[model samples]
Target: MTTATGPDLRERAETVLATLAGPGARLREDQWVAVQALVEGRRRALVVQRTGWGKSAVYFVATALLREAGAGPTVIVSPLLALMRNQIDAAERAGIRAATVNSANTGDWERTYTAVDAGEVDVLLVSPERLNNPDFRDRVLPRLTASAGMLVVDEAHCVSDWGHDFRPDYRRLRQLIAELPAGIPVLATTATANDRVVVDVTEQLGLGRHDSGDTLVLRGSLDRESLRLSAVRLATPAQRLGWLAEHLDALPGAGIVYTLTIAAAEEVAEFLRERGHPVASYTGKTDPAERLAAEGDLLANRVKALVATSALGMGFDKPDLGFVVHLGAPASPVAYYQQIGRAGRAVERAEVVLLPGREDRDIWAYFASLAFPPEPLVRQTLAVLGDEPLSTAAIETRVDLSRTRLEMLLKVLDSDGAARRVKGGWVTTGQEWVYDRERHQRIAEAREVEQQAMLDYIGTTECRMQFLRRQLDDPAPERCGRCDTCTTPAWSTDVDAGTAAAAQERITRPGIEVAPRKQWPSGMAELGVPVSGRIPAAELAAPGRVIGRLSDIGWGTRLRELVDGTDPDDAPVPKDVLDACVRVLAGWGWEERPVGVVGVGSRTRPHQLDHLARRIADIGRLPLLGTLAPTGPRPEEHANSAQRLAAVWSAFEPPAFGMPAGPVLLVDDVVDTGWTATVAARLLRHAGATAVLPFALAQKG
Candidate 1:
């Protein structure tokens, strides 16, 4: 194991801090220790500081130390554009040379390539998605790989699936780190993680010989002395609006009211505006220009209240905020904590109120259901896409469903890895699509097990926070002391029992009722040939064709002109035609399989059948399918860690004891379960390393 003499490292750290810290600046005790450890060149370190604890200062001190010691560049990998902007702004303000690369600024391929190759840039702040780009791997990472410096990952919790904000791209970071040069140190920092998340981060990062002792899990009292928390239960929307209006006048600073949906946000904002409150609304659907204007209004105190979706708070450091009101229940306690944490950032007293109603639970369940799709339908969709790109129109025709129904199925397929879209067409992306029959069956079975687990979580009778914490292997607190359950023990118990019993009844009840399918308009029958089990060609043709075809069948001249020389193939089908098809086919039970299609009436897994039925039902409800569009904003590109590592660490001090003689791995944190720690260790072993040790700023009991 590598070791550094304490006195020697402390001296170097002091020197570095003196150069970096401005006049009259002093390092906090924790920051001093963190800097000293980095000066020792431990190679793997985790820094678990509380929110607003100046965790970034540790890296700033380390960077100055490394640069003064004549080390190469260092890299910092951050997850959000807002975070990147914040760090870049701070670094520049301190007179440090720093650059930020994200989708917003680097709008095209050429700009991305140019920024990375520009050798003069010292520090780079980036998102995780950019690492997937081949250009970064080839043009930028090489310099960092060759440098002797440090690599820092901010918000390191994202690497674990158990994190509140999980992203798929984080899973690929281990492979990206493997390509870096030997003896490079890695530093990870996060404000949250309960034991398991810490271990997951270390294991996933592959830090060697770094023990849990190296981890520093800081403990802070949950009781925000400055924040006043309360919950107001309401029976109707009008009552809630009245409460909001009365409370708005009581709060003096900027306030944010979070709602369940974009529509609700607009309505609430409009209602407040009519009452003479300077209000603005922000949601995912708000146009960019309007969003910027709203943000400016809030920052300048021009707007007294801002009604928004949950997207407004991350990296927004507004200290003067007076209140944060949740118009609806947040999906999870973790989300609630993060959202409320936004207030009182300036150490000032703040108010947070949660307004809970029955509808909130349903909304949460609906979103949770979307996260896990039915495996059987997933498998079927994979088979259909089969590495081929097909438009929604073509997919609808092939699936023998209306455009609306097809679109819904496609959404489920995309989420479950059964399909992916490229250039507005779908393509298969799952292993089942390429596997042999037996293996494919095995994959389907495994998925069934996972699906059942997800359903169990959704239908649980226990405290929701407790259930989630257990899933992540973090020990549940005796009581959260803040969630709805803890706030009103009896009500929580009764609600849990009622919801559980209701879920059981819903599961055991008979299938949902379906309305009768509508008949095709007149003259549709003559448009095309009849295919067994398929909707007639007449049903697929436009109303005009149906009329003309009926006239051709001797209905009369009025119907003849309706069809008017149009080819049956070219006729437009009425929107309702597809809607009806979805309802009837989905309700009747339809399945897509490799051997042949099976109906819901066949003996398939119950959950699979339910999902298929739901997909069809959703499709039928859709107004139009052929012209569906991607809904969210374009995804942002990630950053290159190796390059950033080299730039930042080039100046870091070597370990006071010197680098280890053999191959060494490095990591940032560790927790009790060791899920992340084990994963990182295994990856290092696979990469031909001699030893893989885990390190962190703190360890949970």
Candidate 2:
């Protein structure tokens, strides 16, 4: 092995880069500075560069050089599985061996561990969540920390709450770094960190106050030469969709279509395919297999576009991805920059556009609600675990958090040492946990500020690239002459009348199936509800329909306004909504038309439910069977399925007019959770109805 120095390492880095990026490739000045800091100086470094600036090359080259000097394999903590896979492939091209351990490939963990322990791997990539897992944290991490040659934090912005995409799991990396031996030479890299996020990441990388001075911070101008940024403010979502349907294929090359919600992604993908464009929908809800397949299709240019959520946000590596168009604006400029970073990395030019929507804020608020749980709920969760451990399902019966929310809370708790997740379930550690109200409030306020910044970005007449760079506190930000403001707005600003009309018709058409629950939530017995396992088929409510989901783009807009109104003077039911409901019934194709109509009495919007049922029964000429009465005070909205089910079990009384001889239709304002429908149907069946069907103005999908 040769002595490591800046001059020596730069030559070696050139050889590696030549192999990775053709024989003529040479290291950029900043890329060499990052490599030198990690290898020769043996100091922690934070490299904040725009996407496709060869940040990964710095780490891969450093790891190869350090390993040649007999150092242990580099351990990379990546944020997404896509990143890890991409890194592994990139590593192989440079003649360096790499392996990844993520949730998607647990079966390969043991084999990978064997190889890492035996020195067959040059780089090991693992997710942030893997750090808090007891098996890995207690077993593998300790060994890796002791012998690791270099540590890399990919998408390091996630370690900071100020980042647009913060994950609680990423915070545990502080502990991982704390446990590592001093001067192990760590590298943290991200393309989207603003000033606050950069400060947070630097502090984490410093490890301790004494080492803070030694940490190297390299922040490059965020302007991407290949990107031509533009924003189009459309009046309606349909026109936006129309524009995409008309011009998506005309974009430079294969690229990504980003949506704020999964439903929108699917809807846009379907519309594009209908327009004869090759596209696929990829969201967090997509199966891991399908996501991987979609990724492959995009990488190979087999599909012209992938309609995706932030699930495809960071760490995806496609050298020449030509465009990124947002169906709806992301809540923050930081987030928008990160998503759009997926495009134009290696290409000479890639088009970037934002179609700001009216519904973006609602989506923002829905996610904002998922922050750290309140102190009382956290305490109640702690109290639920006694000497015996309980699975998440058992805890859900006692607590009122959604599975996703609860799991996130549990991870926070685990990080705080208040809980320990074992093989069977979780057990309380009896640790004291402080509820950081001030911190949470600050985070929320920061989100608002960022959201406002995003709005500013969309409406700004100044240079788009310079605006983004200024947000990140770039040292010398300036206008790039390629954006719409700097250059002419070359894109079309109109949706043809015929196309807009067709889109309006398609969007206005509504009917979403409100599928009834087939099985009872687990641990119902503990909640004093005797039911468990699958609901008997005879008692199960038949599949039902709703006018639309409140989260959708079309009727969702109208439904949100109507349902959000709490005024007693609000109209009973708007004529347009009534017509839509009638259309639903007209096209229902029900196995049996409802024999009678029954309203599910509501504490709020009673008039909405009653009027809808009465109008439906009158139109169909069926008898009104009266409303189901509340047995007692309705419990405040339950948080999770189990809690909601337990509350609704005894909340409804059978209809006073008794069940009709045939199936009865149950009407409510909204069918969120569907537990209300399930319990009400069982009540109607017990009251001697042959069958029950549920109808709602909107669903909370």
The numbered model that scores best in TM-score is: 2
lDDT of each: 0.51, 0.85
Which candidate number has the best lDDT? 2
- Where does candidate 1 have its weakest 10-residue lDDT segment? 542-551
lDDT of 2 by residue, 272-326 (tens): 7877899999999999999999999999999999999899978888889999999
TM-score of 1: 0.56
Structural similarity to truth (TM-score) of each candidate: 0.56, 0.95
Q: What is the overall TM-score of model 2 with all chains considered together?
A: 0.95
* Residue 231 lDDT, candidate 2, scale 0-100: 89
lDDT of 1 by residue, 16-76 (tens): 4455545556677777766666656545677765455666777766776665565555678
Q: What is the lDDT of residue 433 in candidate 1?
A: 36
